[model samples]
Target: MSHYDVAVIGSGPAGTMAAYHLAKKGISVVILEKEMLPRYKTCGGGLVYRGRRRMPFDIESVVEREFKQINLYFTGDDKVLTSLRDVPVISMVMRDKFDKLLVEKAKGQGTEVKEGHKLTGITFGAISTLHTNQGDFQAKFIVAADGALSPTAKLAGWKETRKLIPALEYEVEVNAEDFARLSSEVRFDMDSVPHGYAWSFPKKNHLSLGIASTRRKKIDLKIYYKKYLEKLGIKEIIGEKAHGYQIPITPRTDGFHRNNVFLIGDAAGFADAVTAEGISNSLWSGELVAEAIFESGLNPEKAGRLYQQKLEKDLLPELHTSQTAARWFYGYRIIRNMLLKRYGDFAMSLMTDLYIGDRSYPKNLMKTIKGKIMEIKNPLM
Candidate 1:
């Protein structure tokens, strides 16, 4: 039997970020990854400025491209282009290389990473034992960063309470001319899908094209992907099979920790409801858990309480606000279009500010929306 102070399951951004921070703090930590390093992960691979700023170290080596502008398209050719000329709005990177980079950084800081270690079961008590195909390991604390279908949370008797949405992505190889034309900007077509949106993200050699839906009703994502490709005028050029995955739009409200175990990232369902963006929140949540654990002096119970408090104070408020915003943003297309039409620049600027960490969702969002509506209704005022 092997023992460690903390065992981090899943070596994605959340796991590696937690391990990196813990190891840097001189805490004994180990990372268990089911897949080998540099394995491909299905993602749009778009990193907004907020997420890019959260990374402690430089990611220049893996960044495929950066964009300074975003195009928002609506029905009937109504389009708004928002540009931040001086700064990049989003940075792109393939997850395989990016995740490996983070893991390597953690390993450099003395975190032991065990590849091909899949956590099958967990027994909880004062200390928890993790059963894997390779062997058994013991830890005083466990952080489940194992992603959407978290077996760790299930083994601990926690049922999922967050909403999981479907997303489909494709890496399409385009000719040089088309690639060059699209590689400079990011596009979001709001009318491409119902209760969701389609995205065209430019990479170095290909375009990461995808669509996602937040609505509970089942959507044929494959069909939607084909339509999106046709809309982009690239259906004939798409070179690979489409990849699909589920994204959690909300976090578990009941709790994030139970019985000396904690959850972060997709395991905890910490994705942004409005954008389905998980990387920034995942990194932030991982860092927060590490901070909470250290602040608690490694006492698991105290650490769990502290983690919840930190979330309430820092992370949960924004998530709640975003969830409310998403309801209106996606729920009522007429009102959404009205607001966008009247305040397109302001709305886009506010979102851009949020992405760059300059602003947050309004705390009193309903009140804010009411005020905006009044302004639109009485333009003379």
Candidate 2:
């Protein structure tokens, strides 16, 4: 058995990031990954600007493409809206490359990256024992950054409270003509998946297309994806890879940590409610958790409290606001269409600001929406 200050489960963004920070502060940390590095991960692979900017090191080496412009198609093609930022609005990446880069950075910070160590069980105590496929290891703290279906969270006694939504993504290679036609910009088609949206994020040589609905009900994503492909005029198919997963847009009602085990990222359901984007918050939460433990001098209770405070100040509040925005943005169809048509440009800019980490969600969102509805476009209505 080996012992360390912290043992992290999984090497995804949250886990690797936490390990990186903790190791930087001289905490002995090891990341036990179930699979080898550069493994395929199911994601749309669109890293928003804010997330890219937050990285401690440049990720240019792993980046596939960058776009400063966004094209949003709402309801009908006629209702399309566009926004351009001076900085890249979204950076494209393959998770395998992206995640491996993160792990390498953490390793550089003195984190031990133990690939092929699958966490089978954990024994809780002042110092917890982590049973892995390779062997048993012990640590004073554990960071559960495993992802949406976090087994570590369950082992640490957390129940499901997150609002998990279904999403389907495909890596598609089209003919030269189709590739040329769609490869220049990033686009999202709203109302294509009922309350959700469909996105086309162009990679260096292919397109990562996906659909996600915010609604909790049952729907055929394949059916919607077929329609979306038709909508994109993608008549020829070369090769495609498909993946289906769930996004936890709501945070867990249960506590984030117990017995020195802390949950971050999708394990704690920190993805944005509106966008269902988890990487930004996941990275943020991982850093905070590590900071809390380091600052608290490894005091379990104090670290947990500090972590909660950090989240409440920034990440949690935004998630709450995102939930409110998502309710209006997705659930209310008529208002959504109307508002998108009338204020699409404004909305686009607002989202752009949020994506760039320049602004927070408005305080009185519903009030502002009401004002917009009653004040403008009087002639048409």
Candidate 2 ranges with C-alpha deviation above 4 Å: 377-381
After TM-score superposition, the amount by which residue 23's alpha carbon in candidate 2 deviates from its true location, in angstroms, is 0.6
Q: Please, what is the whole-model Cα lDDT of each candidate in the order they appear? A: 0.88, 0.92
- In terms of lDDT, the poorest run of 10 residues in model 2 is 372-381
Q: Judge candidate 2 at residue 45 and give its lDDT.
A: 93
lDDT of 1 by residue, 208-303 (tens): 998999986888988878787777776358377578899998889779999888999999999999989888888999999999999999999899
* TM-score for each model: 0.97, 0.97
Clashes (backbone N, CA, C under 3 Å), per candidate, total 0, 0
Clashes of 1: 0
